[model samples]
Target: MSLGLAGVCLALVTAAGATSGSVVFVPVLSFTLAWTHSIEKVRWEEDYVVRPGKTPGAAPVLEAVAARVRGSGAGMEPPPDARLRHGWYEYTPTLRHPAELRLTRSGFTADYDWCTGGRCRSMAGLLPSNGGVTVLTACRSAPP
Candidate 1:
């Protein structure tokens, strides 16, 4: 699936199969996901890149390039090869393609943050509040 300039469409759907929100990023590209650990209270971020699939009719490829965690301890341990720079422990994380992010709305912690094109916004603010599980996935954007 060669997207070319078609870009990618990200959909946020609730567990009950209702579409909450969606966004289209032109020219298939990269984005960052940030969130605070519930127990550790440390901020973590993952950088992901989206590209055309290897075959026709295939889903878009998703790859996480790097991850950064601020103040590691407890559930926030950085990898051994992680470098400490600017108060952040940075390292590349191993991930499988076609990643589907399942976000839980527990209302007990901060919502996940999505950043793209120099802007950042919480998932709660981006989508409708349903107090349920929300699945975030990438698909081919409709041609205009």
Candidate 2:
């Protein structure tokens, strides 16, 4: 079974360099990644778009990452183009195509939240507690 919704698909690669069989997400075309800075303790959110690959059965592409930071402090500097809106600095940072967003689950700070289709779920709830790195990438289908 797949966990993805109706757009793209994703899987979790643990810190041990092994892909977890039960970890998956049937994501939508757009998703928001939210996490807290390890040191700053400030919240940050990034919106991403998953575009289908040109070739059949090929991995999809991830692009258009618009990010926002709650407050700027240590390691939380917003870009010059960032605009303050509702107490958050919103800006669209440049990102290379096929972006691979790697998030570290240190089991110390708050767990990252992946939001889509007006719903939010913690990464910890979607995957096992490995306390390692979880790579979120675009895929055409859920891994077997």
Candidate 3:
């Protein structure tokens, strides 16, 4: 019963993120639910390649964003079983200021451009060298 309710919540969240066209990061359980719900996770992390003319390297930008997400502590823990199953997801953001970047579990990547102060420019692609990476908590039931 609880699992069912959790599944429903997970579906709603994943749908919301997908339809909104923004990257969303969720804990492992919610990610698993997204898959069960048929919402594909984008792999922006691995698929992104630095285009010849692109400003910043794709790898560095992704690493920076991943670091930022990790540091932000957003969706760090898997929700209780009563809330959802275990898995994690990454997607692009939906803002115009900072380009939306997405990464799925399968290594898909999506990039969007944005405008700033009247000038069109890609938002800071990654965290500055000073920004630290977020530490994700391990799955409780997983083997260490």
Candidate 4:
């Protein structure tokens, strides 16, 4: 009877583990406007000229944003079939010329690339304008 009881307990533990493991955690993408220097003098249709690579302290900014995102209960586990590794984006704005910079997880991953630049086609094509700093996160979708 003791042996049978032991076996039952083991089975119960195993079943519990399996059930917990099957629970899928979706990845959440987040973005923030590190800094924005307005060019109030720009004329023509261009309301404001956007230049990347200008933030003085970007490392800490990115780290803080990442921490906030993680703390928001967003699953940190990389997608099972995720081609690209999880990473962050660093947008650098300059006076003469600025460019949007991204440090993405290498490979053909499919999470979400948060950006203020035209890097992420999904976001670049459709971003609201207000001349202020902002944070953006990608929403998760089922594997294609």
Model 3 Cα lDDT, one tens digit per residue, 60-102: 1111111111111333432232121133333433321222233
Error of 1 at 118 (Å): 2.3
Error of 1 at 36 (Å): 1.0
Query: 1-144, model 2: which lDDT tens digit per residue?
Result: 443333544456655787776646555688888988888889998888888676755567888678899999965689899999999999987774645777778878888887887788886766655677777777644434
CA lDDT, candidate 2, residue 65: 71
At residue 45, candidate 3 shows an lDDT of: 19
TM-score for each candidate, following the candidate numbering: 0.77, 0.79, 0.15, 0.16
Q: Residues 50-127, candidate 1: write the lDDT tens digits.
A: 766778767676777889999877755898889999999999886646467666766777878878888888866566
Every candidate's lDDT: 0.72, 0.74, 0.21, 0.22
Q: After superposition, how far is residue 55 of candidate 3 from its true place, in Å?
A: 12
RMSD of each: 3.4, 3.7, 21.5, 22.0
Model 3 ranges with Cα > 4 A deviation? 1-47, 54-86, 94-144
- At residue 61, candidate 3 shows an lDDT of 15
Model 4 agreement with the true structure over 9-112: per-residue lDDT tens digits: 00011222231112122232223322211222111111112221235322111112221111111233322332322332222222222122222221232222
Report the CA-based lDDT of candidate 2 relative to the real structure: 0.74
- What is the RMSD of candidate 4? 22.0
Q: Which residue runs of candidate 2 sit more than 4 Å off their true CA positions? A: 1-23, 55-58, 142-144
